[model samples]
Structure formats: structure tokens, C-alpha cells
Target chain A: METEKLFEITAYTENQVGLLSAIAGIFTRRSLNIEKLLVYPSQIAGIHKFKIITRAAEAQIQTVVLQIEKKVDVIKSYYEVDNERSCREIDDVRQFLQERETESNNI
Target chain B: MEQKITGAEAFWRSLLEEQVKVVFGYPGGQIMPVYDHYWNYQAQIRHVLVRHEQGAIHAAQGYARASGIPGMVLVTSGPGATNVVTGVADAMIDSTPVVVVAGQVPCQLLGKDAFQEIDLIGMATPITKWSYQIRRAEDVAWAVSRAFYIARTGRPGPVVLDFTKDAQAGLVDYAPKPCHFIRSYVPDPQVSESQLDEAARMIDEARKPFVVYGQGILLSGAEKELAAFLEKGAIPAGSTLLGLGALDSGNPHLKGMLGMHGNLAPNVMTQHCDLLVAVGMRFDDRVTGKLDTYARQARIIHIDIDPSEIGKLVPVDLGIVGDARKVLAGLTERIAPRTTREWQMEPILCDAVEKHKVIEPEIQPGTGEINPGEVVACVAEAVKGEALIVTDVGQNQMLAARYSRFVRPHSFISSGGLGTMGFGLPAAIGAKIAAPERTVVVFLGDGGLQMTFQEMGTIMQEGTDVKIVLLNNNWLGNVRMWQQLFFQERYSCTRMLNPEFTGIAQAYGIPSLHVETREELPSAIRQMFAQEGPFLLDVHVREESMVFPMIPPGSSVDEIMLNNEDWFNYGD
Candidate 1:
């Protein structure tokens, strides 16, 4: 199985304890393992941000974004799929190598 | 014959008649009439004059969470009303029942840019269960009654009622009507027979089945039902952090906590289980580790109170959206008790337990310098099953969660959702107030203790028998720990200027104990517990201590940095 690259999403929130637990609970009930999460006060006055990383399919990523929007304190949440370029390039190389090998074998 | 009364007087009288013992608030110009009416009911009801309007709301929250009754708070126009927003949001997240009454500017001046005028109803709309602005004196009784009704029913949350100056001052013959506004808020507890059957079949067929419980169990008051279900089915269960006390930790079927920093058994079982039954908990990233790998082998059955939680994350084979107590009771009635003895699943569970046990940290026995871990471990060992422990935010909170052995439900109360730093002190006050007979211990770091340190006066004034264990690290340990791990040890603002906590405690007229060593902890704790009134234990602890097995931000659970040298040696 190919190892999928994980992406981290960070959302700013008001400083509250249950906020992280609520966010984590959302992921737990959905059976999503948060790879890593860090929450602290933001540079902006009085706001706190939680940076969470997890691995999921592209479809599931969209679902997570929507689910996060429903959280009470979340002001904004954004995520970038890390290592997408490397992953796509690796897949392309593998496919190219396989096709070349198949042609040689036929010859 | 009933005498004629103004709307404000009638509202206060109705509240007093309902046996509302106290109201938390601060007074202001727009609310002068209401406060005047409030004086007449002073004999029947008490008013706590809080320094900050926000504090009043939080105090009410403490009372409600402790007493399991709807808490009441009254704040005056504009800034006074806006100050209570934090408390409202806090109550909403924790499912605390609170009724916040905010004084609005006069009706005629509402949109005329009057001083201290605000659209509080609009500001509080998203955070409250329901919100209303009383336009007329006749509407006062209905609004107050409805606010209480909506706050206490269903999932239970905060409600706001903005009373116009006119409504508070307007005179009309008023009689309080019975609350009928919450008729639609009632929740259905029973799961359909088909849903029950499907969940049962999934449980019976799976080889490695695991159960995950959340705060919904407590919200639904389904502890007894859940315990019975787990015992009968012999299903190994784990709880989300919020679900800490749902099942007794000593119960053979219980698998401790699940998620980031969760027990190894639950984390591994989650991945290997053929079937997973998640009750009342929304899937959170901390619990699941990595979505792609989480419960890959399991067909999920999600039972929750909120309908939106279903299929929000992991796809569920069966979704039962109702109250946890009702659904579990229904499942128990329909499903036959099954023994996993035939499958001999005990060894699998035992092996998981045996593999995950951390060897006791090698420190010189009875060393005077307090190791933060040992102090936490000792507290866990001492309290074991009795005290309801609340921790402030930062490393202290994480350490407490890690070391504390929670054997009963509601035993561990931390700001899991918000991770609010000052939460521990006030929450402990609330928990103790809720269950006075039960000892409440609050653990706080030096930094966290300072945030809501003012509440120390509240404790002294109430003569509450709550114990505060201060972990004096001399710095914001969590940020410093992260700095050490990720920021190359350049500690910035994490260093905290010292305070004489013992003197602060003494100034509050509370007994104080100071401990600088692990040997001193038990005796200090004993001394504090033996005291007649509230006590604070200021324990000096190592500032450099870090929580191990930390999954660095954006990393998977398997990529944990185990600080325990033995666990690393054992190749875990």
C-alpha cells in the first residue's frame, strides 16, 4: 500500500478548553486519527489557533473542512495537502517505468 | 386578589417563586429599575455581586454544573451584556444550563444610538440555544420562563434574554404563565428496532470489537445503562477524554482513554477491530490518530444525540441519533447477552495491557526535589477514586490527564473543548459546589493559576472546601516544552515572574501548604484535606519536565516521541 501524505489544518478560535476537546471529539467519533495537534494563543489579540494534522482521502478532507465549520468557536480553518507534487510525480514515474518494462518484454 | 405589579417586579417575583436561590450579576444604569425591583425579592433570593459581569455568568455556570440546575445571571446594558459572551460560549461548549438576562437600552432608544445600547440578541444568536428580546412589559414573564425552559431541556445550553429598559420599567398587571415554550425541544431517546438489530448483529459478528464512549453518556445520564451494556456484551471499551469517567477504570472490560496520548491498547484495538461502536462521541482527530488508518478493519455503528454528527467523519454502517441513555437501554433490551469466552479474547486484551504498562520512572526513592511526574503520579495514587480533579491548561493539565487514574464518571473535569487556562480554579469551584460532599481538587500551573486567581476570593467567601494544588514551574511549561522540542530551546515569554502563592493563600484567610519534594506531597495533601475550610498547596516542581509520547504537530500517533527510555528500549 502507498503511504499517503498527511496535511495539517489550522483554525483560530477563542481561548477555551472544551474547544480542542470538541474538535478532537469530532475527529474521534468519526474514527479519524489526528496525526498531531497544537493549540495556543494567536498573534492576533485574544484569539487562539489550533493546528491539526491528519491523513485522509481528498473526499474526506472536504468533509473535515465542512465539519470544522460547524464548530462553535472556529473563526477560519484552512488546509493544504502536503507532498501532493512529490506524490503525483512518484506515481507518474512508476506508471512510466511499468509501461516501458511492458514494451520491452513484448519486443 | 392579586395586587398590580410592574413587569420588572413581576419578573423578579416569578423567579423567586420558582425557588431560584441566587442570581449572578453586576448592576448598571439601564438596569436600575430592575435592580430596584430586585431589592424587594432580596429576602427570597440572593444576589452575588461579582467584580466583573463575566465572572457573574461563570459563577452561575459553576453553580449550575455543580447543582445540575439552570443557572441565572443578570447583566446591564452594552458592555455589561457583552462581557458575559465568554461565559455564554463556555456554557454552550460544556452543555451547562444557564439563563443570561442582559439589560438593553430603552425601546425608544434601541436604534437611536443610545449610550450603552447594543444588539445583544444578535450578538448571542449563534452561541445560545435560543435568544429573545422583550419589547413589552407583558412579555417579561414569558421571556424569562422560556429562557429557563430552553436552557435546561434537550442537550442543555446557555440562553440569553435581552430585557429593554421600558420592559423593566413598564407597569402592567402581570401573572407568570407556566412554561410551554420547550414542548418542541424534547428529544427522542429510543432507537428503532431495525437500527438496534443492525448494531447488535455487527457486535456479534466481529472478532475484534471495540467501543468508544463520549460526554454524551453523562449528558444522557446513561452511566448505569452503559455499564450494564458493556458488562453484558463483554465488549472492551475506551472513552474519549471527555468520556473519562463513563465507566470505572478498574472494570475488566474498560480500555482506558483513546486518542493522542491514549492508552496503547485502545489505539491499537481501534485499528485492528472488526467492528467499532462509538456512543455519544463525535469523531475527533486526537482519538482517531490518522483517518486513513483509524479502525480500517471495523464497520462502525455511531450512536449520538446530535444528528449532524452522523457520517460527519468516519462512515457509519448504522447511525442511531438519539439520547445515549435511551439508545443504550433500547439496545440492551433487544440484544441477547453474549460471552466472548468462546472466542478467547481475554489474552488479546491482556497482552495489550501488559505491553502498554509504563515501567516506574527510575528516580532516587524519597528524593526531596519534586519530579513533576512523580508529584502527579502520587496525586493520582492518593486520590485514585474519590476526588473530582480539575486541571488548568498547559503541561500541568496534560500531566494530570496522563497520570491521574480516573475510576469514576465525572472524576476528571478539564477544559477539554476549549483548553482554557483559568478553567481549573473556577471549574473546581463549580464541581465542588455541585457535589459538596465529594472532595474537589484543582491542579494548576503557575501561569494558569494567575489567569483566574481573583476567584480565590469567591472560594474564601463561600467557605468552599476545595483544595488547590499549584504546580509552580516558574514558567509557562507547555510553551517552554514546545520551545525545547520545536523552537530550538529559545524560551521567549514563557518565563513567569514568581509570586508567593502561600502568601496569596494566607491573604485569602485560607490554610496553605508548601512542598518542595515528593516526600512532602502526601503529608501536605493530608494536611490540606484535614483542614476545616478551603486550602491551597503550593508545590514547587521541576520546570523542565515534559509530557512524553508526544505526537508532534501534524505527525501520526505511530510517530510518537517516547521520552520513557525503557519503552524505547523495549522497542514499543
Candidate 2:
């Protein structure tokens, strides 16, 4: 089995409560677990956006978007994949490399 | 032919006919036309000019929550409208009925990179129950009506109506059709009898039954129905934070609030009950600490007006989607009331009372420093079921929740879902303005008070006779408490320096009372209620006090660490 990584997806909606519930309902019915979710107004264009972190496959992501669009208030849905090359990953790598350097210096 | 009137005039007239008494707003360039119209209808509708647009929206929220009526807010285009987004979102989360009207740039200038031409509809989409952009002047009445309907109807929340400059200025052959608009959007409040019977049967048959009430009690004007149901059934009722005023605090059937910082009795009973009847509340994580363990002992029945809310979190054994008051009324009519295992339930109530008595902090009569709990209890006792209480975020809110005694729906107002600071003062002002007959009080910490302390001007200007009870702990009490417990007393930026709140209130032309000792509280409260205009009672409390039985974030309800527990005995 492949290791699943949690990715935060920002789905834009026309700020309505039922929209978030409907989108979550889609994932819920499919047995997709949402790890963490936060919905707030976006900085741009004032559309309501959700930051939902869930563990699912790429195919599942596409399906989530399609289902989300079916909700009356949702305008668009997109994901921010948690990649190793991301800034968070870079911080981790830096810490690991620094630890190695410290060990070598001690030796 | 009908007399020609601008859309702004039609909007104002429609609002007046709807019995809208007050509107909170700050004027700006694009929205000047509406303000111009506001000048004409000054007799019917009073417009309060807030220092900040955000404050105006929050005031509307305060008013809405207090009055049980939809609050109206008006803001200009661009930054003016954008600033109110937080207030609208706050109202949405807390389920306060608010109608936000924003002035947009001219229709022709839209998408033309014109100044103050931001998409108000697009911006307000997520933070509103419903949002609409009015392009034509003729649509003004319909849009305003729709906004009010969406705001005050089932699952009440904030609704936004963005009027283009052209729409506001354009003339229309307008006849104010208030009755027609209301008739078109009025929600049917009937529930299926079979479903109601099934729900009642489940409640009747259960060995241990628990009832959970939320903001829907106030929104549906169902306090009478809820109280009657609890009284007749003998079933214990618990409330979400937003549901504080649904049942009287001293009611024998009441089980206190259920959540992260909820009483031990309610939390324990939630898990122990056999049948859990959740009305008008989505089982948010705050209410149900850990999903799997929440109501583990119960078979749940969820009832809400919004179909989406039913079974959104914990799976329900029976889901009834309808208005809470109507569903409950139907259920009450169909089902004969029966006693459960009275012996088993009596012990639970006794234990809860015993625990409450034990946990209540004792105060010495002449102590120079005030006890936060005692002050809250004092205010709660002073208000005595008459005042509308609003609380700011942090320890003040929790303390108010724990200690305050509320007897009716819409009496306790706070930003529950968003937990926004600087919310209490403005909200209290709005509440007081909305319900001038009733006393309005706000419980605010030193830190939270300063965040929107500028609203002192709103109270002064409006001459709102609101009593602000400031719990002066001189610190960000909740964060400091958390730091002491979790981070080994690494108090960072949590410590707040000083402010003479009494002096500040005096500057705003409001009378001030300073209570340093517990003995002074009774007299201070008396003085506060006696005064004419707005008053501030600054109670100087002990800084090191912490709210106990706190279930830390991401922790299970059963894993709560009581104050009696040793530091090492942290985990369940």
C-alpha cells in the first residue's frame, strides 16, 4: 500500500454554509477522511474559500472537484499538494543536513 | 403611474415597512446615495455611524442576537465593504441574522479596474447565507426583501446585498410591496407526523435520554416549546455555547453547556445517555470533543432546519430535517410523556449540582483583589434573568458561560464559533440599541476590551444605556492559563500592561465604577443599573486565576484533566 500524504485543498465558493457541508458530504460518502478543515473569505475577489486537508489519491482529488462544483454555492475547487520540495520540506531537509554537520564536527 | 423613486429610496422605504428600527454603518463615496436616502427616513430608522465598518457589522450582529430580529448593516464600496467581511463571517458562524448592504461602483465601471470597484458579491459569497448583486433599480425591493428573508429564516445567518452605484441612483416606478415580498419568502414550519412520532418513540423508550439545544431555539422563537418539552419529559437538557439562553440556568432539568470547556455533568451525561436528541445544532468538534467517543453511549436523533446539518458529524439513528420549533411541537403533540429510570437520572443531577457547588470559587468579603468567577456570578446574579449578556473571547467568555445564569433565548450573546475578540463591547451596544427596554451587559477581559475599545464612542453617540462589566485580570487570561499548564509557564506576549478603563469610560462621557473588592460588587452593580446613560464597571481581579477542567485541544472529552488531578496524572 502506498503511503498517503495529507494535502490542503482550497475550494472557492460563494460563501454559503450548505456548500461546505455538501462538499464535505461528498468526501464523507466516499469514505474520504478530512484531516483538518478551515473555511474563510478569500483575499481575492471575496469568494469564500476552504482549506481542507485530506488524504486521498489524485483521481479522488479530481472527483472531489467535480462533486464540489455540483454544490450550488461552490465556484471552483483546487488542491495544494504537500510535496517534499515545498518550503516545509526544505526546512526539514535543512534541519537534517545541519544535524549531520554537527555529528561530523563532534567526531 | 407609480411615483418615480430611486432604488435607494425604495430600499429605505422597504426596510422601514419591515419594521427595521436601526441600521449600523459607516458612510463612504459609493454608498453616499443610500445615506442620502437614510436622511429622508431618519424618523422611522435610526442610523448609527460607527468609527469602523467592521464595528458597524458587529453592532448589527449584537443587535440581531439580542433582539431576535434581523440586524441591518450598510457599508460603502471597496475597503469599506471589505472591512465588514470579518463581522459578516463572525455572524455567519454564530448564526446571527444580519443583512449587509454594500454600495458598489457603477455597473459600467465594474471589471473596468475602476477605483472602489471590488466585486462585493464575490467577496461576500462565503461569509453570507446568501449574496446578490443588484444591477437594475427595479430589483431593489426584491433584493432587499430576499436578503432579509434569507437572513431571518431557517438556519439564520448573514446575508449581503451589493447595490451598484447606478442601481442606487436610477429611478424606478416603485411601489413598496413589503407584504408581497414576505409572503413569497416565508418558510413553511411544518414537520411530518410519522417522523415526529418516530423521534418521540425513540425518546420515550430510551433508558437514558439527553437533549441538546443550540441557537435554533432563539432563531425559531422556540424557547417556549423547548422549555415545555424539557419540563413535560423530565429529560435533562444541555446546550451548545451559542444555545446558552435556551433554558434557565437554575432549571432542574438543565444539564449546563456541553463542549471543550463544558461542565463535567453535561460532558459525562452526553457520553452516558442512551438516546441523544440534538436540535438545531450541528455537532461541531467544539461541542463533541472527540467524534468517536462523543455520545458513545447514545443512539442519536438529529433535527435541524438545514438538511445539510443533519448527520454531518456523528451518524444519526433518525434524522428529521425541519424547523426545530415545528418539529418539536409535532413530536410533543404525538407522543405521551413518560418518565425514564428516574432513580438513575436523579443521581446524575445531584452529582452535577454537587460538582457545581464544589467547583464554585469562594470569595472573602473584604479582599482587595476581585475573583473573576465571583464577579461573573455577581453580574449573573445582578442581571437576574432580565439583562442580555455579551462576552468577548478568551477566559472572560468561558467564565461568563460557566457562571452567568440565563433564563430566556437570545439573552446571552457571544461570538461562539469565531471566538472573535473586540466582539463583546460593540455587540453589547448593538444589543442594547435593539432592545432598549432590557438591560444589556458585556463581560470583557482587559486584552479583549482593548481590541475594539474604540466603540466606546458608539455607546456615547447613541446614548445606549449598556453596562460594560470589565474583568480586569491585566493579562490575556486564557493564553496565559494555557501557557502555565502546557508550556511550563513560558508566558510570552500574553502579559498585558495597563489601562485605566474607568478613565477611558469617563472620557467617553459614560459613568464609571471601580470595584477592587468583592464587597463593592453588589453596590457597584446597583449603581451601574441606576445610572442613565452607558456605564462601565471595571472589576480588578486576580491575574493568576485559570479556568479548570479544561480539555486541551485535540484531546478527548473523557480525557479531561480536573483541577484536583496531579500534574503527572494528565492523560486518561
Say which candidate scores most in TM-score.
2
lDDT of each: 0.73, 0.78
Candidate 1 residues lying further than 4 Å off, grouped into runs, are A1-107, B17-19, B180-186, B341-359, B362-368, B406-408, B557-559, B564-572
Deviation of model 2 at B352, angstroms: 5.8
Residue ranges of candidate 2 with Cα displaced over 4 Å = A1-107, B177-190, B343-358, B362-368, B564-572
Q: lDDT per residue, candidate 2, B237-311, as tens digits?
A: 888998988887878778678787777667767777899999988887888887877877789999887655655
Residue-by-residue lDDT tens digits, candidate 1, B346-429 = 435534443444314312234545766566777766776677877888878776776677666768776666566777776676
**DockQ of model 2 vs. true complex:** 0.02
Q: Clashing residue pairs in candidate 2, if any? A: A14-B125, A15-B125, A15-B126, A46-B122, A46-B123
Candidate whose DockQ is highest: 1
Native interface contacts kept by each candidate, as a fraction: 0.02, 0.00
**What value does DockQ give for candidate 1?**
0.03
lDDT (C-alpha) at residue B469 in model 1: 88
Clashes of 1: 37
